[model samples]
Target chain A: MLLKLLIFPGFLFLFLCALFFDWVDRRMLARFQGRVGPPWYQPVADLIKLLAKEDILPTGVNPLTAAVLPMVSLAAVLTAGLYIPFGAFSTASFEGDLIVVLFLLSIPALAYFLAGWISTGVYSVLGGSRALLQYFSYEVPFLMALAGPAILAGSWSITHIVDYQSQTIWIALMQPLGFVLAIIGLIGKLKRDPLDIPKAKSEVVAGSLTEFSGRKLALWHLTMNMQTVVGIFLLVNLFMGQSSVFGPIPAFLSFGLKSVGILLLLSTASALYARLRIDQLATLGWRVLAPLALVQILVATWIGG
Target chain B: MASPLRSLAYLLPQLWRALKEGPHTVKYPFDPVELPAGYRGRVIIRAENCRGCSMCVRDCPAFALELEREGRDAYRLIYHPERCAYCGQCELSCNFDAISLSNEFVPGKPDRKDLGVVLVNKEG
Candidate 1:
């Protein structure tokens, strides 16, 4: 169990998968924009380059806080990975692990908030506040959307949800509205296009990341990418029935293919859409997605009951 | 609200077209770049036709050219690529058809001196 948590299907596997997914996102975005993207090893190269750079801490900022937040964010995401079922294996799961995963997933964003807050820069403060606001707006719909699957599966355990899907149809088909809501909520959570206000480069100058450099910056980037992997992993396990229809090898292959498909879907959406303002993002999350998610939960509960 | 949905409908077809068209970027460096007609890149000096005239040196906006006398009637033209703006003024000012611009734009050198091009009049 320790080996599974630390190595395969856990930290190492998720880390590598996160890097690959980021590459795919960048490559697809570049192709969409009529440009050649970086090579496949670009993410690894970037990480190495960042590590080699001199760590620069801004004045009037707590050096310890700045140094520790990135690791905290990364650890939070890696710990979240432990509960996620990849293909036929889950590293560590228990009753109500979904709640644990949900809580763990938010830690990185909170770390981002704290990092921004501690930076003592105007842009960082603005970005930190925006990040906190965006979190509040999206969390409600995101949780409500998850409730659809949990209600239908009758268990909060991720493994139980997957097993339920194997015995029945995938929850995505049953809760199409919930699936759409979840995707929208995820786009906001991931800070992708049409909802990428917090780190809007033109406005906030890299948002909360303005003060970060060197190894901290690299770890922050790694954490963001890992969040993408964890998000898609959760999406697949909860909505798309994972690995039940085939043998272990095929199940693994199918899981990979599904995750890639989700990544591509996100990339395509990001390429096609423009960034939204904070007000617009809030409205979409609160007025639109939240209500839709509530309706989905109600319908899912009615059907399940 | 409906507009976002409408844009999404418009985006799907556009995304499909982009995927079908493949990547629009050229594999530069590995594959040869397709330069347009009359593309002015680096300046080239024709030493045989050059009469050591200072018109090109004077007209160079970037002051990238220098005239040196190797001996009496033996003139050598020196070009500093680092200082060159590649504005084609030197190519246009030369009356002897001595200097022209080539389409080779990729400038690479191991040393600073390597960027300097020197041409000597062999007949002198």
Candidate 2:
């Protein structure tokens, strides 16, 4: 049980997948911008370099909280990974695990908010506040979007959603608006381009992470990468239908291909759009995305009922 | 503000073209850089052609050139490339074509003193 949890579908697998996906995302984004991207091993090399660097703590902040926030965020994302059904394989799938996974997925954002709020820097506080504010804007739509899939499948479990889609059609096909909303929400949640207001280098100079360095910073990066993998996997299982398209093809390979397609779409969107202002994002979310998500839910409910 | 659909229509083709054409950036270090014509780089001096008139030294804005006159048309041209601006003023000021900027880029060196080069004219 320990071996299964720790190796195949757990930390090691998630870690590698996170690095690989990061590379793919970066490469695609670079290609879209007409620039050569980093080599495949750049992510791993960066993690190693960060881990090996010296850890510096600014004076006047609580050392324990500073140290613990990143770990907490990382742990939360990793735990969320276990509940997700990767290619129909899950170590801890249970009733209402969807809610649990969503809840678990949100811990990092809170931790990020605290990470900025607790720090004494001007940029950190500003970034922290932005992260918290943006959370409300995207999270509502994100939740509603995921809820569309759940309502249609009639189960709050990821495995059941995948199973339901395998029998019928992809949730994406049933309600593409929800899929679009979910993808946008995922970008906001991950703080990628167009929604990366909190960490805009020019505006905030690494934003909430301005003070972080060495091991803590490395952990934060790993947590973000891991969260990306988990988020994409969750979306794939929710909207991409079955793990196997036809007989003789393994489930994981199909899942991987679908995930790659999603990643490409994400990278394309990221490259195409400029970052929206805080006010613009809030307006778009409440006025546009949230309403559309609500409509998607109604449509899903009507279809399911 | 352009509508989202219009923006998408404009950007999608650009992104597609960029992806198909690959990166426009030159892979430096991995590939050699192609220098354009009349590219100013390191300075080279011909001591035998020098008139000891100190025109190059006087014209050098960076004060990188020092011509020590030994005799009529005999000189020691000392060039401090570390301080050179590569403005080509010295090259233009040389009446006898004693000095010119070559197209060879200067590589970085640890020691500051190694950046200087000297050309001695014994025959006057």
Candidate 3:
């Protein structure tokens, strides 16, 4: 009970903060396109409404799966946040290797895949398969891209990575290839547009979420939104780690501002590009992105290592 | 192979031109490209030309027009932006040329209740 108490608030805080980031993302994208976006409170309002809405289950959906799937996704994402070193504070830390973070980060998609499959809906089955493939395609490039940063700081631990960045030039400068690839990979993992094949609205109806509605649907949607925030947070920590001095207002605003910039970049891409198909996405990852990322690793290792 | 090589040689300038040219991506958030003129967007209505005729009311694909008639003859119009598909059908059907599809896309809602676009009679 006590441990649950400890975990709950942290997860809640992360979820709420993630939603704020999503709102900022929409706002920036709106500004980018010369349109006024939803207000910052929009995400909160949306979640509230979605939670209050009727939960609709498709025929043959396992009630247990429906109830547990979203919670698991949310739990996994928040758990990673516990481990992730944001600026300086990591709720849990060990030797600072992102190996743990990488595995933990995979939880969201894994949960999404399981949810998609267990729903026993055709749309979800297709979505689940696509999702599995999608994660498979991007994880390699993401790992390779991250390897450059690890090489620079001589550590896989993100705190050390951040600390190392402050000491030297930001690793982004030394390993531009790695930085760019990582950003691309970040976009991929977030399942944002141009790589949003799994959740492709045009192809799969809500992709993995076609059968979900009401509170359960709300939780699932909420998890994805939070994952977006986490994705942006990870990117910020890696490339633009903590630019503000410590204080509630200033630290909050600065962190918020850094995240908004990332969100803006993400949303802009989302607005401009159409999503690639599953096979094309895979090909892009393995054939194109992998080679390009490999070049970065080669260069970073040769030069920095 | 020779034919392909010839084709490559012939296409060398094009390849060189592409290499010399810049990236295709718009430098967004900095250099926002212009939205096309006919881009489907929010609908705005000119109250002056908007006669009391209920043609647009019936013709709107979203059934977006709700005429709130006042003072027996005087009237008010409510346009639901959320429901309005921006299909340009309303603009096309409006004989008085009252409605236009503007590029301004409003996405936020202060309240779900604030759904209607109110057209109050400001005319003297």
Candidate 4:
């Protein structure tokens, strides 16, 4: 059990996957833009470089909170990964694990906001505020969109949802709108392009992370990268269904391939769109996506009944 | 036209083409770059062909060249690459076809003073 938690399907696995996925995301995005991307070991090299650098704290800042926020964020994301089933192996899967997973996934954003707000820099404060505002904007539609899968499956367990998908049809085929909304919400949650307003470099100078350096920044980066892996895994289980698409293929291998497909799709979307303004994102999220997600849930209910 | 979905439909094919074509950037330092004809680079001077008329020195816009006459037929041309604008005025002004710009570019050196090259030294 300790090996399961610490090695396979746990912290070590999630950390390695995070680094690999970050590299893949960058490579795909670079290819889309007609450029050569970083090498496979670039993420590992970057993390090590950041770790070896000097840690600097701003004047009048709480050093403990500044240090701990990124740790807490990374811990939350890692813990969330444990609940997510990776290739039919979840370290901790239980009833209502869906809700627990969602809540855990959200802590990083909150930690990010606090990281910005706690900093003495103007850019950090502004970035934190923007992150908070964007969080509220996307979180609603995201929750509502994910809810369609749970409601349609008639169980809150992600394993149950995956089981439901294998027996019936993929939820994505059943409710394409929800699938799209969930993807969009995942983009917002991950803060990719078209939704990366919080840390838009032109206006905010690395946004909430303006003041972060050394080990703290590395942890934050790890947290974000791991969050992407966790988010893609969740989407794969929720909408892409089980490993049935690759018949006779190992469950883990299919799960990995499907996750890469989602990563490529995410990278393509990131490459294709320009960043939206905060006001524009809020308007789209509430006025457009929220209603669309509600209609998706209604459609799912109609089909399920 | 204003819709993202419509825009995406148009952008995807272009992205596909770009991916197929590969990156436009060269490896640079690792690979030799092919320069074009008539590309102005470092100035070269032929000591044997020089008439010591000082036309090249007089017409130099950047004052990057100095012609010091040692005798009636002998002259030395000192070229300062740091001040050279690569305008090719000196090359054009040379009536004896003694000075011209070579196609070979000068690579950067750690010491700026070493950039100066004495292109001509002829003794009477």
Q: What residue pairs clash in candidate 3, if any at all? A: A96-A157
lDDT values for all models? 0.86, 0.90, 0.75, 0.90
Stretches > 4 Å off in candidate 1: A243-245, B1-5, B34-37, B68-76, B110-116, B120-124
Clashes of each: 0, 0, 1, 0
How many residue pairs in model 3 have overlapping backbones?
1
What does the lDDT come to for candidate 3?
0.75
Model 2 misplaced regions, further than 4 Å: A243-249, B1-4, B69-74, B121-124
Global CA lDDT of candidate 1, please? Answer: 0.86
| Deviation from native of the Cα of residue A32 in model 2, angstroms | 1.0
Q: Which ten residues in a row have the lowest lDDT in candidate 3 chain B?
A: B15-24
Better of 2 and 4 by TM-score: 2
TM-score of chain A of each: 0.98, 0.98, 0.90, 0.98
Candidate 3 per-residue lDDT over residues B1-124, each given as its tens digit: 5686565345345434543553344655678557788887887878778886877888887888788776666787788887877788878888989978887666788787878878545322
Candidates' interface RMSDs, in order? Answer: 1.8, 1.2, 12.7, 1.1
Order of candidate numbers by TM-score, starting with the best: 2, 1, 4, 3
Candidate 3 residue B92 Cα shift, in angstroms, is: 19
The worst-scoring run of ten residues by lDDT in candidate 1 chain A lies at A241-250
Give the alpha carbon lDDT tens digit for every residue of A30-144 in model 1.
8777677889999999999999999898899999888889898889888888899898977888989999998999998888888889988899999988999899888899989
List model 3 lDDT by residue over A200-221, tens digit each: 8878887788888889888887
Expressed as tens digits, the lDDT of each residue in A26-49 for candidate 2 is 999999889999999999999999
Give candidate 1's error at residue A107 in angstroms: 0.9
